[model samples]
Target: MTITEPVPTGPATTLPGALSLRAEKQPDETAYVYLRDGEEPDGSLTYRQLEADARSRAAALAAAGLGGGSAVLLYPSGLEFVRALLGCMYARVAGAPVQVPRRATGLARLRRIAEDAGTTTVLTTAEVKHDLEERFGDHPDLAGLTLVDTGALPRAEWTGGFPEPEDIALLQYTSGSTGDPKGVMVTHANFLANVAETEELWPVGPDGVVVSWLPLFHDMGMLFGVLMPLSSGMPAYLMAPDAFVRSPGRWLAAIDRFRGTHAAAPSFAYELCVKAQEEGKVAPGLDLSSWRVAANGAEPVRWRAIRSFAETFAAAGFRPEASCPGYGLAENTLKATGSRLGEEPPVLWVDSVALRADRVELSAPGEGAQPLVGSGVPVLDSVVRIVEPASRTVLAEREVGEIWVSGPCVAAGYHGRPQESEETFRATIAGQEEAGRFLRTGDLGFVHDGELFVTGRLKDVIIRQGRNFYPQDIELSAETSAPGLHPNAAAAFSVDDGERERLVVVVEADGRALRTTPLDELEARIRTAVHEGQRLDVDEVVVVRRGFLPRTTSGKVQRRACRARYLNGELKAAAAAERSAR
Candidate 1:
């Protein structure tokens, strides 16, 4: 149950060193392949070519006097992002991979990140730079910044040495689902340690091929799509996020074509693939037997999604045991715990009534039971403790509390926020003062039967009449309540109505469904389902067109943002129904 042994450290300590070693060992071997539109091969790089390109980028950065400072990496998902990231590693410049700004809000976020990192340089492709300049050339926050197109850099040789293990390698910005984004300073050692831990859990042989359509800005994408394969000396197949979004089947087709052994995405993506297959959108006769690890993370792991996907893809030689559920955060790099390879992920059914009281109890298969999927056990030298948030007391097994982790993978702290970092990253457990600082995860989970079972985020829990409720549970009920509701597009939150807290549910519905089904009937179905399922009366139900509800970049419903929009009358509700419930 206790997997605390350290993973073997490789001869290379830093990312640049790892790539250099791989280049020397396998110069002609393909290191990465870019799949344009998730199907056609557009470009590729051998180990030798990749290293040379990275070194040239490093040389350009050094010549620009940008060494030892941070630069925002604003490239789209492709080979350019990978080269720029590795180039920063070689130059000892902290690379902050940020999503390409498409709107005012995204641009504001980019400006905040740039200000926080104390940098005025932006590294991106020439096309993107030209477009940004044409669109937002006179924007106040962007006017003073210098955008350097990496593709246009003059050829030069890198003479700088590799960065030290403790040097900052990346500034992984947290997904601002609930609040402002903060940059987590990930050191070179942190990346190496996380890769080592992942390799120990899911060993990738020389034949391993990683296929990913996840955005490089996200931690899950950077680790699995770039770092893991690079460190394991395996080739990775990359694709843009839009390709998978437009056609979920492309992801599976890529796996089939490339014989990909490892791939990962959020749970909704799995659900989408299932829907696509059911709709006859996926290509027929896919041989997915080669996929060894179908990692599901970056969001809550849904047992329904796992079971549905395994059952749907069973005809394609997809093994049920290949589904790996994991738990992690930006603060801990990528993964803290992962399901063992070649084993079925564990699921536990707990009494719903007891769960509301923060107690775990076995329950039969009925309306009163709620399923909790196991996210596996800790890997490497990582130590996980379930500590009561307010009391700072360590809880026994099966007792739900905030998850605190300490390991080499944990980042140093948030960039330029000393006070907040001290509170979050330097917390001491009660009566275990000398056990080293633990990173407060703000997640609620417990170690039951030697496996971690995450409950919900501490801040997202809704309290109604002194009873605890998780927004995900409420959102799930709303999703299945009616056929018109969009999958994974419900936001449940409580709002104060001059007295106590009242439940409010906001959901997105397809245009066809909206036209066919009566609005009153749809609202009634959602309210009745929640009332019967959770024994909680909904005070208001607002239904909007599809894509109205706000979502984070990783596709998680931003409940707080939805609540704000609802309060400010920004959400144009297609139909709304309210009840005076007390």
Candidate 2:
């Protein structure tokens, strides 16, 4: 990573305000490059071109009487989606960037976002509009909406003022795989505030190059990947998530080819990249020294896997300190806490027994030590606290509890959800003199040495004999206990038995393993391993074929969904136990 001075805090706190600044400073500079498969970009957008495209679409929306209203913008991964979203901001309209419904994949979520946002207008590209018309022409949810192709609209001579700092910029919809989706109403100021914080910590400037393959509909990818380059005056390279999945090496190759200075993805992606290089799938001699900010966030941070990645890629000029493990959610607009600019990612060795007792115990290298990677402290002006869920009392340092965040980056509230918003976004910590309002993140973690170590989700924590056990730890034990299981292809949860919580483990193995290994023996290994690791009795163990486990769009294992499938006997064919253990 390139060591540099910390970036100054945000001068432009709004997208429109930032756009005007970029246009005035370096209008002809390249802003973004959209790549598909090869080295060269499929399409490119410059500062002037980006501003003009957004202006044309904004003028079209204004002419259509959509000013100061909400609109759903759906488009495939490309530069056109960029134009549509920014155009909404320029038009002073709240744009909801959602995945287009096709063959009933994500249609229901789209409907909910549209209804929740109170928007009837659907903004998409010409090609996607044809697909929606063919697949959802008679659909009731989209029947009354005006479908506009921002790409096809003739260039309008836009002459109106831009959006205000307090104007609505975008509506970020939560992935509702576990439950119903909610639209997070993000203002322009909120989005830019986060960008400023990210810049201050990561320290990227006009000389930097940003690369991303994360989906644009998600917050991590959209705000940091698509919009941050515009605000920071850095050139960016964009690719679809599928593009990277098809060939993980393409992501690293893009970095080497374009001299990428900043990039962010979930931990799973880093695993994929490391695996690709290990398997000789990536071409040799790819230099990653230019990769300054290799951020890992939007999912669980693994200490061993990331350290292994840094060590493995070090032969290719990858620095160990470049990998950053951070934490954030949709409510904060984007980044909240992340790694420092020039420090190695921190990891804590703690006692596992004490972890279950709501305590943080520092342990030496051996003697039942569990290593956890640190999610660095708050950036810029955001504040974080660990609070007891039931009493809402703030927890002391090294005490595990629910995470609460409060800052200007926090959104006003969820769109059209007064009650839910008040409950979640307007939470107050009990017994604190200046508790004030905070956003309950529903995540369980602790502060050690002033850094965050997120343990697990509050709903997914397994309680056995009044002690808390994180399912991810148990799932890791299950995956590593056997040779057949795949990493991240496991989900662990607890079955509520009224008296106490019993552990239930579900893992994925290839067809070869399912056919070769005896199911009884496999289940016993998983049971014994989880029991030994978490000190909890395993009630059930199920091994399904790979791809059977349900996952969120961002690649998180859906424990609640897996529990539903287990209760309904949908996963019986994979691995079924005759007796239930209590």
Candidate 3:
């Protein structure tokens, strides 16, 4: 680990981004370390070597007549996936790294996304060659499309190269919730802003090692795991998501083995590790003192999850101050706001009754109701405002409204969708005529003590008898109060009952643990908790088997998918679905 002095304050180059410059400037430093498959020796690349590979591949694609504007999709995460994406950057091509669907793997999604991007080239590994051949080998739309597999072809050689900071580096796929995923155009300017912002807020030196198992398809995973480390000339320890899922203890072990200093994950991961500890599944005695930045993001942060995990791992030398809460979306590149390293978790308690009735009220803990975790102030060069969702009135701090972001890090817009882009990015704010044009986040939150506290998405909120309710509030209550409920294994949604919406919570029950506790009593207690904790009338409490809740490859709960299945009559209670056949 070598320390590269920071570039002095001056006019910054917005194009071709930081990664390309770091590759050229620190070519000999280790850029990445891929944990070899099947227990082989780990594979690594220096900054120079990785850049050379990217340049060679870009030149190769150009020689093959696939250059600018050509779209290529990588298979989730790996050294190959990242190198190919960088190659796209080097060639000035728009790259889309997609999540390979487990049900129907192939160029099915690729062909559609490429067609949208006007792309004729696709990059992938040999493992999915047969699927691609079977799915789109004969499709008329894929005619003349070039499919390059690095697994089969020898590595292309390069002479030398670099890209400008203004070039389009990657086309990030967004809307993992509903409709066909749309591409978010990210330029070198966009990429550099995210890197600088993250570095400024949570500075990591060249001596740092980033250990990640996040799927690289998503922007956060790709930026944090690959680009962030590479730009800083730090080494990254990578592993397959399956390995982490099978044994989360391996993640902690990997950190201990590599003496990793920085890591990031969603709240569910923290909950999962806590469960592993409670079940005696994870081995004890792993040292986590080397960790400095433990970022919790990609979804809403649950304070309980953080507290529980910190308590369980405190004896292992994990510091609570290292825990960082952040907020970001694909539209703002990868990062937006994060608590600085070695800072206490920030929380804002508010009047529970006022929060539900009026939507904006902040107070001290015990004086009010629930204590919510704050998302922290915006990073340097970014400005966040809570404004009226309809009129765009910039409200004072502590006034709850739609969260809006305006800054250099804010992305240009959604790719290929002018209508959606106009609606999301073109909103006018009260104040300066040209400045404070906030990006409507569709998220409801308030600013308290100069810190942002996100409650829930505006679209995801349930309205009942003129009072507002967030699903997370009810879900968290059930997890805390239910006896047999699996940790962090519950979802709350709303169903219309003609006049108003009704609350429905589905808890993933631990079947083995349920035998000792009465099901009737457990259900009653959960219902009571929800009613008392959140003041919502429970319509139904469906307890299903563990591992039944569907999640994205990146470990985010597919709430829309769950709601779709629930409405389509596919999801059912474990006992009822079993008894029906008998």
Candidate 4:
């Protein structure tokens, strides 16, 4: 399953310049479909038209005194936003896209990203104009910067031109919901290689139409929804995230309406679709038979979510083989591993206890508390291996270790922050960090029968009583043990109190439901479950309101934010106090 085979469709055309290689293959095909407010819910642009628009925007940016190697920040996702990114490519300028937060507190995230990049020229939209102006307008580092509005940009200014493949095309910033976001430097060559590899691994035929609600700022959305379709000569059906959040049914409806055959999303998205189905929100008689590839990646993939989604949507003709779950990161240009075009879901069940103890022991269903989905074998030309955390020695099959990856898919390295880059990007073979450099994924997992299975995170592993426990396992147990707890709402982490580590379980409570229940019963239920199911002695079980969980725009829970609130005495430890009163 190592990535060494040529793409079934064959190599891309010899492009004279970067961004042109893929564009040359499909000049008249639709590249992007944008959803906007007050206007038509969707807009489409062909490869030729998008290229022209990008060139015009690039010329305008060049006229504004920006040129090759200059870094610009892109904030919004739409047809115009895509045009601006293309403009950067046409002008030989590099641009980074950051995740724009919907709330005010998210401004701090943007500021942190700006500080990390040390740039000022930002591409924004009218909706976020005031917020950006107020939050970052007066900053010294951003002086003399231009904040271009994608919606208001004049289309008459751009004229089609081309840039070199060696020229820097984009700088997509990582969604540092975990830590500081780094600007990943990508050239036109990187995009071509990745797109070629993706097409190789999962071929999209001429009739294929892509539909996606994933944000364009994100790597998967931009690469697959916007870039790959153009390269593959396919149309994309796009809707806004708000549209899908408001009515997930619309996502399926669009697929039915457009006959979309290709799409991608995180694991939670499928879970949301399943919830929407349970609420009877899915339109009747809608068909998804045309959906040949529904890629699941970008974050941790849960087996429960995948199976639930497949079962719920079976009546809609969504094939089990169509649901592809895999692995990747922004550093690898969005895709690393995924199911073949028409294969059943790849999965592996492992013993929950031995998995926590540096052992990659497999188990049958119902024998373990958790079963992780396999992210599939490496894509064409990519390599995946598991290495021991301390020694970096390559472990054999079914040996739990830190995942190390190499191949053409790995990005060059992070932009700036050399020391941090060295630590993360350098690979260790035979006890040396510099032995052979591969992207240190910081993820804990192993290979079984040549398939990659990610259990959880290495840093997120909670150590207590000389035993390693995965927070994901404890979190899942709490959600299953309690009727009211929201799935994935609970976070379990270990904190030190001058001695051994103490296990802290934080679950968002159904505030109204808790208020009605007898306090004794609620506390008893939580305490019993933590001790019995997880086999961990908990010092505290803090429960907040139902809507208390902090999340990134991509819907990932912000555990650090929860920990911060718990430490500051903002969250009530109702369960913990109830147990003490006994």
Candidate 5:
């Protein structure tokens, strides 16, 4: 079935309106339950309280002379951030929710975003803002921003209400894991349509207990953890993402503790869940029968990860049918496709050799087969087409091509980037004049038997632990790690070493460093700088001699060539790194 715009939900077209209706209809009903560090609830709020808090925050923004514009939201994951988002909806402002950066490079990115969005006002918690200012006061990137604590406002002063359906509600910045981050304009209509369609796949009601530990800044986290509950009239239980990282069992234990019915997470989380079970860290009394929809999306869903999770947790009342693998990007408003509830997640085993030739060949039970989990069909309100990238010709089922999508849930365009918006959001078909709008997702996938199987990205993006890391960014970080490196002679890439994505950085070690510094020490320095700047680990740092990396005629580093060389065991390092070729 082709996707369609949402059928009207009785004045609940916009998020704020839906929330207001819920509060009026069930004022005393619990809307959200938040946990900070333990199993016990840190705080809870009812629909009435949520509405009041949102309105009060909006009123505060209005009093501060901020309206009809966008405001950057800077807060950690918690109820305060949720209210800030809701308050933006009521204030008729688009909230560009950003995480509080902890590093200088991250600060620069936040600065770039603020400058791009042209915002001077920032919404944050009083405590968080005060602490941030104290820590980041000297940094010019944050010095000019006027921080407003929306949570501190009184409910009586709330004046802003529901916004227009077509008004811009949020600017979900693309995850920059593949490239530079750009804001995707998500209108109220887009928000409503996506929420309605997502709920159809993972059906839920007021009694549906939703548990989440995703960071609110990520689109996947924001869409599922913060907005989905309000739109579907479900109660959500939230814990900070860091808490889950420290203890994956906390996330699973939360479901068992709360009898959670629906939950969404990235592939890493499912892997972590499996790791927890293997380590015997999972709660013994955990019962997952109530968790019917354990949806995994945001990153490339691995069949092995889902299969391990389902197999390990089957004894705990978890059903294989509950493992839902899906696909989505920020440009499509979070979820473009997902498995239907009660259906075992779709998977395919393709011959590794044929796949390289852009052909799909089903593999035998035991061979050099690549396992790919199907992201399921396009949402009811969305149209997904596998298209030949160069020709724009729609491909037949099982023919691998770029994934293109169109629907009401599709974003308007990239914010302030008209050319990119037109190219990515309003793509043209090869010959179908009647096709009005389609988004060219830079993802390679195929449709077989009405199921979409994403293979890999068309861009040189390294997706690790569900976060996209651009190769250029990593290369720059590595190049500038020390002055000994040759200019534009570093490459960064990711290769899956069976278990997970391994990041490899190849650099040209300068003659001075080769003579003066220990090679391993230099590699360690590069690792520390990259980790400090990008907030992630590098699997290997290859310090090669001059002219080691492949370069094009324009002196541009051929990252693919470098990746090929490394993968083929042809890359040589000048440093004495006992690195084994993966």
Candidate 6:
């Protein structure tokens, strides 16, 4: 169904303004609760406390002449990042939340982001500042940065007016799964619009509580863990991403503890939780009855993950309808489409052969069918159109093509990237020029029965003999082909062998399995599976130890990077393969 323009939720223009209103309305209400190690509460902030802390930081930022400029917020996941971000809003400084570098590659990425934003100021905690200073001698690029400890900022009253609606509030950097990261300029208006659209779609009740372990630097985490809860006047319980990674059960325990009504993660997270339960990692007799929405986004929504999670958690009071698959990107300010609340996510089985032929044909569950989970319809006030990338012509329903979106929720553009911003954010639809510019999302999807079914990324499509083959299909086949392959740790791409493109599948194998199973036998299994499943010959199969494959900060496999490493012979194959090569 078509979504019309959404009604304004409130008079608050900026995020700071919304927080102030909430503080005035309910000063004693808890705004945020930080979980230390994802188990015990470390600290909690009331609305009054949060507003005061943010104002104090804002005053300090203004006094430091940071207004109208961007500052990198380099902090671990905690309440400090939240306060600093809100302070930036109050002081009219665009906050760029970046993940703290932990390695050489991470430090390089940090330098690139800092250089791209043209910012010298970094707002971080005292501990982080000291650590960076100690390491600055090794990395000269980071040595020149001016780090300000937000905790040391004096507690002064902020008198400055809130930023305007169109003012840039954040410089959200892309995950760079495909390429270099680009900072999307999300304005105050874009933030509010997206939050409003989310509320309209999800409609959080007064008793709603948000429990999240998503990284604050990522778009989904920022919106769901912070902005959405604040906008909805709900309390949020947040924990560091590492905590959740260490034990997926911590996330569920937090939900049970806080009676959390809303939570979101990628499809892999749900799979992890299912695995954790199967391995008896989750606490016994845990009641997740309070979880109203289990949003799965930021990656491909897998039907296997959805079904497995529902069945595994059914005894814990987790309803099947709580699985809400969604589609979004940083360019759209977070959410583009979400499954309707309190409804089972739609799943469609299609003929795999027809899908390769760029056609959607209904098929029953069988050997040649693929199950696709719907990511729901366009959110309120947003317009989604499927367009043929080559001709830029809108496609009919169920016809797979590039997804284009238009709405106020769309970010202003990429920061300092005029040409790329213009090309990506300002595209006119063929024969519909009057409708205005649309953001060309490089994703492939189609609308079937008014529900969006994301197929794959347009750039990741592998063309062989004039037919399109999606990498995800091949990756799925490869993962199931071998018994020891790590789930979602496979990258499938094509390499040019001078004459034609040859298919190569690079996968991560369990270390224990590599020791127990023969390398040749494992490779044979994968090759046989791909040949049987997709009827495509595998040119090469590279197996490496778990966590060796290249991945984005958000945990998405970087196929291009993997392909480059394979060609450069930089990838160190598993022990067995290495020994076999010798």
Candidate 2: worst-modelled 10 consecutive residues by lDDT: 1-10
Segments in model 1 whose C-alpha atoms lie over 4 Å from true places? 1-10, 177-179, 572-582
Per-residue lDDT of model 4, residues 355-384, tens digit only: 768786667877454577888878667778
Candidate 2 lDDT for residue 246:
75
Looking at candidate 1, the ten consecutive residues that score lowest on lDDT are: 573-582
lDDT of 5 by residue, 500-559 (tens): 889999988756767776777888988987886567799998888766666432234667
Order the numbered candidates by lDDT, best leading. Answer: 1, 6, 2, 5, 3, 4
Each model's lDDT: 0.88, 0.82, 0.73, 0.71, 0.79, 0.87
In model 1, the Cα lDDT at residue 464 comes to 78
- Among all windows of 10 consecutive residues in model 4, the one with the lowest summed lDDT is 1-10
- Pull out the clashing pairs in model 1: none
Q: Which ten residues in a row have the lowest lDDT in candidate 3?
A: 1-10
lDDT string, candidate 2, 474-535, tens digits: 98889887766766888988776797666788888776677677778888888888878877
Which runs in model 6 stand beyond 4 Å of their true positions? 1-10, 177-179, 572-582
* TM values, all candidates: 0.96, 0.92, 0.89, 0.87, 0.80, 0.96
- Compute the lDDT for candidate 5: 0.79
Q: Write the per-residue lDDT of candidate 3 for residues 1-582, one digit (tens) a residue.
A: 121234323434532235546655676877787775312336777777775677677767777666667676757457787777777776677888766644432345655677767777678877665566676667764576677785454456543244556666788876455336677777777787888889887888756999888888877788888878866668888877777777777778778888888888888788878888888888778898898888888456778877888899999999999888899888888777788777877876678878876456667767347778877668778888888887778888777788888887777777788998888976777656587465777878888778788888888777777887877888888887855665557788887769776677877777664665566677788899888887777888776677777665466656676777677766664547743533
With candidate 4 superimposed using the best TM-score fit, by how many Å does residue 91's alpha carbon deviate from the native? 1.7
303: Cα error in model 4, Å: 1.1
lDDT of 1 by residue, 1-582 (tens): 111222224588899888888887888999899999999999999989988889999999999999999999999988988899999998989988888888767788788888889898999999889988988988886877889999889988887678889999999998754347799999989999999988887889867999999988889999999998998999999999999989999999999999999999988899899999998999999999999999999456999999999999999999999999999999999899999998999999999878877888978777799898999889879989999999999999999899999999999999999999999998999988999999999999889878999999898889877788988888888998987675689999888889888889988888776878877788899999998889889998888888877777676778888889988887643344222110
Model 3: colliding residue pairs: 15-164, 15-165, 15-166, 16-164, 16-165, 16-166, 17-165, 27-48
Q: Which stretches of candidate 5 lie over 4 Å from their true place?
A: 1-11, 154-156, 177-179, 461-582
Query: Clashes per prediction?
Result: 0, 0, 8, 4, 6, 0
